[model samples]
Target: MSAKYNHWHKSRHSDPNGDCVEVAKGSGGTIGVRDSKAGTPDIVLELSRTEWAHLLTRLRNV
Candidate 1:
């Protein structure tokens, strides 16, 4: 969402071309992900803490 409301963090490895996404911890321990290139406050994905951990584990395995 908006930066004023959500503190979004981008990957440290992201390139200058803006090919990346931002993530933030939301209320009730939910996680929000959004496109870094998009200026609008649009959350592309939302996951619970456990779901986020599972996704990261799966991604690391790949």
Candidate 2:
């Protein structure tokens, strides 16, 4: 079955002008990110399960 994902929340550090990145996730192992402003393409940066975990760990330390 295809798991569903949707934009949950906007970033707290988002631009005051409503120009920010929207993020979502799927059950499989992918993150969906896109620009909040109109007229922009959705940027889907796919990562392997292992890669995702490593990335998360690195980000937490940042």
Best by TM-score: 1
Tens-digit lDDT string for candidate 2 (1-62): 24455654577779988787666676776665556675654445555567768877998899
Model 1 lDDT, residue 45, Cα: 79
RMSD of 1: 3.1
Compared with the true structure, model 1 gives a TM-score of 0.75
TM-score per model over all chains:
0.75, 0.53
After best superposition, candidate 2 residue 29: deviation in angstroms? 3.4
Model 2 lDDT, residue 33, Cα:
52
- Predicted candidate 1 versus true structure: per-residue lDDT over 5-45, tens digit per residue: 27888877788987777888886567888777777766457
Best by lDDT: 1
- Kindly report the root-mean-square deviation of model 2 from the true structure over all alpha carbons: 3.8
Return the clash pairs for model 1, or none: none
> Residue 29's C-alpha lDDT in candidate 1?
69
